[model samples]
Target: MKALIIGATGATGKDLVHQLLNDKDFEEVDIFVRKPIDVQNDKLKTHIVDFEKPEEWKNLVKGDVAFSCLGTTLKTAGSKEAQRKVDYDYQYEFAKAAKENNVDDYILVSAYGADPKSRIFYSKMKGELEEAVKQLHFTKITIFNPGMLERKDSDRTGEVLGSRIIKFANKIGLLESQKPLPTDILAKAMINSSKIKSNGYSNIKLGNIFCFAEKSND
Candidate 1:
């Protein structure tokens, strides 16, 4: 199957791309990025695109399944509007194009506390994106809502400290549901979901995401 991905440069996105390229089930792995990457593989096709101008690259979103892992932190984006543009607008547009291109399956990496009525700005944005994509109505939609993702070689002081705290809590048999999940594990779960023959929407929450990662291939 052909796999399409946005946010291929992110930690989870990178892991997803690597796993997809290695997986026997996926014959083509197309990644839409703002700049060229160094990775080279026969199955991998990188499309440098302007997320701001989806009209120029929307046609290339064609694939059997599309993965939306695109996001940005408020610190990196510099403002709420900029962050929303990346997290909400860019991702929503990608999903729209995928649906328009006849992609039947869509897998999204959303946060655990996402709700359309969320009080927090980031959570609200993610929730809004979720709703927007669901409106597109793909044949199969799987939303992975992970908490405290344990990214590889993370440099964010607050995130690293928060992860450590969560790990300590996990060791104490507390907050097991909120455990810091590795990006690779989440990537595995996403791939597993796409392979499953399902209809309608499936929301994989924090604890369930771990189980999905361990699911045996058929």
Candidate 2:
């Protein structure tokens, strides 16, 4: 299978790329990024692209399944508009190109509590992106909504501290549902979702995501 990915530089995306490259099912793993990545593998194809110009790279979106996990924090983006450009516009454009090129399956990494009617800016943006992609109507669409992702060697002080706090709570049998999810687990779940034969829209949220990771493709 041919796999296409956006946000390959991100924690979740990096794990997804590693898994895809190693998976026997995938023969080609294409990653679209703004800058070149250091990894080298026979199955890997890296495309340095300007996300704002979809027309130039839209043709390369063709693949069996496309993974969209691109995102940016408000602090990193420096403004809501810039954040939306990365979190929404770039991702939406990639999804559009994938649909246009007849990619039948798409897997997206969304956030917990994403709702179109959400009052929170971040939640609302995520919700809006979810809705936008759903409208494109891929043959199979799986949206995984994970809460408090546990990234490896994370530099974000708030995220690292929050993860530690959540782990302590989990140790006390509290907030199990909100336990920090590891990026590798999420990547495994996304790969597992693609192997499922059934088609249509499936939203795996929070705790259910863990189950998906353990699911057998056979």
In the range 79-112, model 1's lDDT, one tens digit per residue, is 9999999999999999999988999888888887
Q: After superposition, how far is residue 103 of candidate 1 from its true place, in Å?
A: 0.3
Pairs clashing in candidate 1? Answer: none
Model 1 accuracy (lDDT, Cα): 0.87
Counted clashes in each candidate structure: 0, 0
Residue-level lDDT tens digits of model 2 in 1-218: 99999999999999999999999999999999999998999999999999989999999999999999999899999999999999999999999999999998888888888878999999999999988988887777788788899999999999999999999999999998889989998998889888987743344454635221121122
The lDDT per prediction is 0.87, 0.88
Worst-scoring 10-residue span by lDDT in model 2: 209-218
Q: What residue pairs are clashing in model 2? A: none
Error in Å for residue 198 of model 2: 0.4
Per-prediction TM-score, please? Answer: 0.93, 0.93
